[model samples]
Target: MRLIKTGFCSLVTAGSICGCTGPSAEKPASEKYNVLIFTVDDMRDYAGFLNGYAGKVYTPNMDRLAAQGVAFTNAHVTATVSCPSRNAFLTGLRPSTSGLYNNGQWWKAALPDIVTMPQYFKNNGYYSAGAGKVFHHTPGNNPPCSWDEFQDQVFDDPWYFQDWSPEKYWLDFGYRDPKVPMPDWKPLNGIPKIGNNDWGAIPGKEEKDYGDVQIVNFARDFLAKDHDKPFFLAMGTYRPHVPLHVPQKYFDMYPLDSIVLPVIKEDDLDDVPAEGKKLAMEGNNVFVKIKEYGKYKDALQAYLACITFADAQLGAVLDLLEKSKYADNTIVVFWSDHGWHHGTKQHWAKQTLWEECTRIPFIIKIPGAKYSDNICTRPVDMVNVFPTLVSLCGLPSMEGLDGHDMTPLLENPQAKWEYPAITEIKVGNVAVRTENWRYIHYFDGTEELYDKTTDPNDWYNLAGDEKYRDIIESHKKWIPASFAKPVPSKEKYYFDPGTYTYMDRKTGVMIDGRK
Candidate 1:
């Protein structure tokens, strides 16, 4: 491995303010390039470029990135949920390999030695810094060793600013500050507030006060400085995710009368298997409640508002990067952890094996690629992110990665690739996605098959048809015969967010944090 020695600076504190102390390395920009990863939360195919939404969506920043680089239209996630999906992609490991199947399982405890994508860059002579919801948005999930400088996720919710859990000491781990509450905006659309699923514009809050804006500021400050080494910066925005709350202007962008709801069929779940139906009915079931209150369109408006709000934040960062000195030498990768469902399949959130919860908008922009506006329809997943970045940045090759390198597809969008994207909800529940077909196999032996070429909405299931048995068998061969057992959840361990350590309840063994 090549060693590029450079100066160090502290970008996290106001005292240092990106102060560097040593001589710089004079390497060609083409020889070594910086990396910027912009990760959004729960963002689906609602962007204007993807054309997944029926109504018009405002996402110029996302569209600009797509035009500047390769857009993987058939990209999916390793796991549909936030925690496992983020963990699997960052580590380049599948759920079965990591044994992390849900949000409750602490990856720091389960896979302590697993090196994340940012850590790999940092280890290979790059200065890594990250902000916002890069991992699972938990305190201990993002260990110190993951980056040279890291910021935990900050929330702009009303509950975050209040002492809602003063009795529970574990919840008060210094992630958010207790301040005066904003004016009550709960149920802003006249719907009942189901936990944090509420959405509305804050009374006196500015766009600067939002946590995602603060995250963009973190990146802005870091990019304004002069770094000696090829830096790797991660800016993860938490929006279009939950609470769907933003400024009044964002909500005003979508009028209630003009807001368009998703094309959801009444009998969409009729052909779904028992396991698939059970997964759809899981979670908060906010769809049923929203429909009952007759505020379904209002809820969708909030979601779109949040998506536009997140896009604005992304546009700001992209603008800064464009004007910076590293603009011509930085490799940009933008992606979401997974897709989300609005009202499709009778589901309110993710954790299903359907296309609505699996397909995501993925774009990667290398500095000087051969082509622009490249759209790769080949099926790919989040696991390919780690290996692809490593290859693009000329970093040392990593071993034991479940995903294949997508460098060829970047060069030629229509490259011949046969690797199907595999997504897992839990251990045995997996979805195999190809260019035209999506095959799902549940843990109980029930299955679902959809032909994307004919039925893009996945309203029909042909898994039971004997005539298509060959197509089903072709996809079924990709599923692993055995899966690794799931790891113990956080509830089964005594977790200390301060030290980022976990003590197993049954074995009385301690799992140390990565730091």
Candidate 2:
């Protein structure tokens, strides 16, 4: 197929869309290279290279990739939850700027005119395709702004799920309930019915049944296809989230007795303020279910098992890329939406501004990046993916993009840059992270500060200490004056536990905390 220029908005060369070819002068100038991006869900910085869980797990695949490219030690998601975090990442804006603070909100309300990162790629004539949890939901409801085509993006499909024992478990309590038998057909209400046990548990030995694996298969085949022009493939994996389901094979990697849990310290929550205490209390609802199964060790194992499972699945994609004919020109950027907290400070989810929730994994392998095989300790956010890829692809950069161009750091990991990263849990609860410290200020005037250089465990809060007063004050200067303003009471919020019969199992509680 011959590429042609249809209008000023698009240009096409005979065999290439962008028309820029190889380093050789003999090739055309407008040829474009393929772009491959893999975004994982609820994945924290647990790779072996980061020493996140140093003594416990070994992510050989991630470590190998990090050694080949820049592994950002301080990458954060603008928002701590799924919807808001993903919105900020794809839009190249902060959650505050995007107006998507929670899953209940809509992106249109946040940045109505926002031209998403993938949309720009599509505008440039790239064959954009996505599979598995790319957008917060499936197509037609709230599809992402970008992408010319989509594949296997089951907004609710259990991508990155785990298989185990004689049964496979759902990804989250919201996805299923062991209290009841599995439903013949999934309930089709606005909400889910986890309490009703609509999500029946199944055997986990079927390794190939996991959604992330299937998504990878699609991508590997896509990469090996015959295309006349460069392509943009974004494969999203939902793993290390919850319900911690994986195949028994992955689980067998670690002995049930050997699966170590993070020490709770028993008093980890004593230092947290009222605001944090309230958040932890709300998250406990999920834990109550875990306790019912007497699978506390199983649950903990499930998380670790899920991480290892996701890592292995990730290797499959990496393997395909390394062996592909387009390996030289294809750029790979692998990242997690956000982090999760398992009994950290007595919290079991990612709804707070703690390191387990805010700090995420960010890895990028730009083709022909000047300094390959480097480690970047500079702070960054998921929003950086947009501008970074745009500039790397030789497209006209978005003027004043909310995210900074990381090309320089990718080329030189030791490059000097002092960019501070901001992550939001609520309008009043915002955390600012820098090279040596993290400062979180609550709208209610409460604060928590941690010195990563000295207290990486976040065991101590320096907000009240006079010695660190100046440092806390300095970090405050970086916070924008704006505060979070949630949508008014008129809107509806939903967190369907699962679907059930005769009863509307998907119910939600609303609060107008406006004092």
Candidate 3:
């Protein structure tokens, strides 16, 4: 199987190819390298370089970064959802190990002692600062111990942040006042507004005022100043996620007429198992509604526009870093929480174990690594991120991490790696992805097998075929024998943010999770 390099040269005909062919820019040696991580929300592999989408994506900044860094071409997330995925990667623990299978459970309330990546860095004498939706976008999730200074996310959309009562929490599902000016094109494609499901250019909203832009501005300000010690700066972009509201200019980038819908077969779910079929039907049900309205192309255009807008925010910070004092010594890690689906396999949105949901564009830029502008085809997941950073920065080895250090692959893209990337949706539901195959096993003994080499769309499930028994066995070894019991949801405990204690809502008994 040939892997395409979605570098600037391959995507655009007129771009310079010098960055792809030359060595990375030389930087002076430093005692401790600063860390700069950009986490984008609901972004799939739709970079101009990754080509995750069938339509032409305009992401010059992502392409440029790929050309200057080592792009992990076959990277997958530990979990498919935002909360579990971020928790698994940041905490260096898989959902199976942490028992955090969904968005309702707060990690701080469930497992307080777990040292997150930022907290680990802060513990190791590094100054930590962050802004925007790094965690689950909940107020209580971002504890003070993780950072010396942090900025909360602020949205330009008027519908959001209008009310903030304890009952409403940070993200209230209730509707706002009818007088407020919401996106005129909401329920875009006439589909139901299931969980902020809308996208378009919000009139009178400037690009600079967008929530993601404000987050990047904070990072840029931090970059502009010289810190007393090496800093760990993390910035998150909330575009291309939901209510895909951006400036008019980004929407203009992808005209509705030029948008190409994802290629999906009518009978894609026929061969899937009961569990797989259930997940596919959930996605297909949404797609069916989208198709009934005859607005699939319009929806794609809005999603594509959001992706480009997010890319622009990414470019802004990258540009500032290049011009800043820490350009040489800072390590840049760009990743999305999970991938989004645009009518792939007759499915819409993420949460499925399929490629569109689990696969992501992961790039790590070590200033003076032996290899740059290279592609690593080995299967790696977000779980390796924490330990890999620890190894790269020469920090002491952390005990009890589920992932292995990926330093060898960073040093050499073709290094021998035996571990396959594993992604989980809930307890006992897992997807094991490798270079040539993806095997999924569900809690009820249902299974799905796809040969990535032949069928990238996973249109065919070969799990029922006896010929692939050995292949299934090989992938099955990677699955956990037992999963940890799920922790109680936030409703079970009344959390005191000041004390970081969880009290039983019914019993009124206080329990300190940090202990």
Candidate 4:
């Protein structure tokens, strides 16, 4: 790979700062490009450009990236939860392949030697760094060796800034009370009490007070520094995830009366398989409780507000990147770990093999690429991200990755693609998504099929139909030949965030420590 000089200096020209006198000046055609990845949590295709929500959500920043890049309109994740889905993206493997199916599973414990996306870049001379919720927020999830520099995981709640101490922050933020259990979600004005399920607008707090703001600031500072080697920077934002709290201005963006809730059919779950139904009700049944209390619109408003707030933070980082010297030489990728459910199939969260829970927002902007403002409808998975980045930046190919390079699709959005996007919720439960069909195969051999052309909401199941038998058989071929049993968790090991180590629950032996 081409290498630049060790030192560089900046030059100011007519209100613009440019790096001209150094390795940046005589850049080689073979020089590797910088990579910037933005991973958002619990975000679906609610952006205005996706039109998945009938253009009701306000996501100008996300839409802006789509305008300047190629948007994968039919992208899906390998798993629906934060940990498993992110693992798939970083390792280019399905959850079954990695043996990490749920948020409780740790990647280091399951696949200790796996080369992550950032780790791969670091191994090939690039400086890798990340901040915020890049990996699952559980202790030991950040994988210190994967990054050259990783900011300590931040969980700052924008609504609480009364003190720097965790105890005071929790108490002042209404997470603790003398009369009841801390974080107990009691009904507030008829709203159900689910931990971090409530939403509101916090006034008078600057954006920097929020955890995401700190993440962006860290990324901005990284971009401002002159680097001889290419950089791989990851900025993960948590919002629109839960405890939907944002500045009041974002809440005002969507008036309660004007908020539009997702359409839910009374018999939406009728055609879903028993396994699918079980997955739908995995959580606290937040959707049912909210509907019973007649607060669906209010909940929807909070979610939209959080999404807007997240979008604003993204805009700030993007603005800074555009103004930086690396703007023309960087590739920006923005994606969500997984999708969220909003009353679809009476489901409230991810961890299901359905459209609402599996589909995600994926966009990539490669500088000097031929395509822009293009939308690719071909089915793609989050696994494709790793190989795609490696290929785009001219990095040496790594072995045994499940995803294929997406450079072909990036060059030509309308390119023919035969492979379908696969999403596995558990060990044996999986879904195959093609351009026009979604076929779900559960662990117990139960199945569900929906034709997007006829049922965009996935309201009907055609798996049992005699005419669709051939189609079902064809999709089943995409399932893995073998399954990897889930690695030991819960009982075998527990994490200690204070020490950033994983200890064996029984022996108290430290199994893994942060690098």
Candidate 5:
């Protein structure tokens, strides 16, 4: 296996493989460094350099990941939904491969052979510690399985005990409006009384408290703990997700007049096939009808505020690391489970093939890696998290993994990379993204194609536009190798017949999970 190196004098001509041929080619430079993976629940590539974002949202901590490491503008997770998207990342398997398609499902039933990324870290002499939402709904239940110790920074589950503090509580407890929420609210509570306490971030000040502080507080303490050897810390943050909750301070960071919603022409859904239109209209089941630009802007602003809070929280972790003995030797990898969609084609949240939904923000900062302040637009799938780290850490690349080693791109930022990544939604919908093209295969034998080069907004679907069939054919060249695994019955991914996920581990399978 060869790795790519930046600034190398060698070049590849018309027909040659310009690969590993330097002293750095021996093994991964990050082998012995401690690992810290900072994952935001739902975020976009709006950090700093990704540039096309429409907000005043600036992530200095996220910028650190990109400036000091590699920022992947073209990275994507398999699903936009939480549970499945995360299962794919941790298991090194696609949602299709792992049989994790919806938040309504569990991974253990269909894919018990899987070992989570942290589990892999724990297997080898690392003291793994995790805080917050690492594996979606599993939340606090993540068991110190992969981690030596785990704690939920927020309330027990999705709702927190501190809900009464934020304004969102007034909405759930005050105004129960689902479709339309008030555009205005007061941030009377301001900051939490406990400086290092863990709480959840609900959209406005009322739903859930800002959870970033809670998660990062536990994470920083873990980093400062006495360690006999290297440690692996996983910090999961649920922000920029929905019911968007953040402190009034973060919300104030971006004024309403300063917000800009995506441009959607009246004919935006014209090219979309009937089925794609159906799904888009359903908005991944979370939303039914499309809200006007004004409503979405407010919604998106809340999400962005959560991101801002998340950014500052990330700084806390980085601050503790810079002060710790392991500062220079630890490797930090930051990513979001999946990208989000805020009224693009009338969709919000995850579960769409659009770039806004599938593309995740990935940043890797190895202690002494060759790349820095580099933006690799090369397409990378969520599955690659497995093989990339394994190779970089000098661990044998796992056998039968879905992703390839990304070591080369880290070095040769603009190398002739492979084709686009392939992601699956349900069994029938498949999306492929090459450098400038995005193609989707829908469930009703319908296909949606967009010439990303010409249609950045994906306003025009080119699937049936016979004139562009060649470009569509080109994207098809990299159809993922299909496996013949039988689809598990929907019953398989559901909670065990008599089990309550909230109960103690010893009481694992008995409450029917019918709450």
Candidate 6:
């Protein structure tokens, strides 16, 4: 692991060769930083730094990384969808301890031991990498010992695309076209006229023919090279997740008669809970056919023009990480593997448990974090981004982690958490959320709650209000006591992909998909 390459006069005279300091000093507790995660797909809390959409959504590089730092505003996601919320925050663990509740299961066929979060930053030395759509791209669901390099998930796709017309040919890639019509052309009454749930404005694709602009131009050429270890990179963009296609100047920056939609409430499921109205009118309810075909302001102006074309590819990867050379020791972060539901509880996407599919848009920053714009508001989780990047990069604390140490909410954004985030989506379904309550429960026992400081869009349910029954038994003591058993899905296993292993579709053997 001796790759070396130091600079800026060996980071200002390597104080005893490792406690180096220079680029504006202060980092030297044996130096190692550089992480930068940035994931975004199916983003929610419609960023202008999480105002969760009141309308005009532009994002300015996630509001300049939430004004450079802390911004948690009660983040969440233990699993809401997107491969069980990115396999429960890259295996900090919880789809009921990795049974992986859907996007066709396969967290290495249900926890192949489990290390992940870039294989624990490539088992400590760090130089991980990664690119578009981080995991759950299927065929073996990513994992090659969790990246020392990764990058080609077809670089996320769409360099060029067209063809869905012969009566929308079953929306192509997912097969289906046998003379169409089996619930094919719906056009908007809850919207699913076929796959990737259609949206428009792709006239002449540009912003470098996106696939998140080749995953932010491979994270701006891996932050302009010259690094020797201390990297981890990870970009993963895949726009507002779906055919919300972009470019027409981000669909002329969301026009369709000035878009705004989402207020719903045709009695917002009346007092909700028959398992939250069977997950808001059940099976593909697509906001009750996008409020019965008015196209809910043309699918909310194609999801705010694919979220301002994924925030101009996250302002061209944060303007190449503030013009590279690991911009004063990188840590960055910016999240979003969950939280979407475009029509609030009438639901639209992200396998609901709610708070618009588990809140999201987390944001971190760190590089010399003594706290900047800091927000926090308590209730954390995203499996506390794997033990808060192993206690902010000092490393080494990995035994059965179920998330904690968010470095005291990134150095006190009013820290004192007491845990409430939770989430899940199946197997005894959950939810939780806190910092003013949300609860939920489902899986037949049925419940719901919501108070969130006087119902911030959770629209009041108070779970049979017997004075909130000790706040629903204290958020049901944080759910998951035991669940696990679900696995067999990358279509019943098989895998191999050059021996990354897996097989077992009824014991045809193989299994060992690494740890």
**lDDT per residue (tens digit) for residues 1-515 in model 1:** 11121111111111111111112322333466688988898888898889988888899999999988778899998999999999998899999888989887888777777888888889888999999888887656777778898875687763543432443222322322245433455446565536457788877888899999998888788999999888989888889887788998988888888877888798988999888899999954578778888888888888889999999989999999999998888888999888888888889998988888898889988665546337889999989888776666656567888888776676567778879999998879999999999999999889999999999999999998999899999999989778888987777777776777788888888877756
Model 4 reaches what TM-score against the true structure?
0.87
- Collision count for each candidate, in order: 0, 30, 1, 1, 23, 3
- Return the candidate ranking by lDDT, descending: 1, 3, 4, 6, 2, 5
Q: Which one wins by TM-score: 4 or 6? A: 4
- Tens digits of per-residue lDDT for model 5, 371-392: 5337788988888777666655
If scored against the real structure, what TM-score would every candidate get? 0.89, 0.79, 0.89, 0.87, 0.79, 0.33
Better model by lDDT: candidate 3 vs candidate 6: 3
What is candidate 6's lDDT per residue for 1-515, written digit by digit as tens? 11122232232233312321223333444476778887888777878877878777888888878777778878887887788888788878887777778876677665676778898778778888888787766567786788878676653232212232344432533354554433332232234444557676544446676677888878877788887778787777777877676666776777787777778676777887676676665534655665676777877777777877777787888888888877777778888888677766666777777787778788887664445337778888798787677656656567787877666555556756688888887788888888988888887777888887877887778788797799899889888777888776666666766768887787786666554
Question: Model 1 off-target regions past 4 Å?
Answer: 1-30, 158-183, 370-373, 505-509
Model 1 accuracy (lDDT, Cα)? 0.80
Worst window of 10 by summed lDDT in candidate 3: 14-23
Better of 3 and 4 by TM-score: 3
Instruction: Write the residue-wise lDDT of candidate 3 on 107-153 in tens digits.
Output: 87767678999988888778999988888775456667678888866
Model 4, runs deviating above 4 Å: 1-30, 158-192, 494-499, 503-515
Residue 190, candidate 3: C-alpha displacement in angstroms: 5.4
How big is the positional error of residue 45 in model 4, measured in Å on the Cα after superposition?
A: 0.9
lDDT of 2: 0.66
Of the candidates numbered 1 and 6, which has the greater TM-score value? Answer: 1
lDDT of candidate 4 over 402-454, digit per residue (tens): 98877667666787788999999878999999999999998888999899998
Ranking the candidates on TM-score from highest down gives 1, 3, 4, 2, 5, 6
Give the residue spans of candidate 5 off by over 4 A: 1-31, 139-143, 156-209, 284-294, 370-373, 480-515
Stretches of model 3 off by over 4 angstroms after superposition: 1-30, 156-195, 370-373, 496-502, 507-515
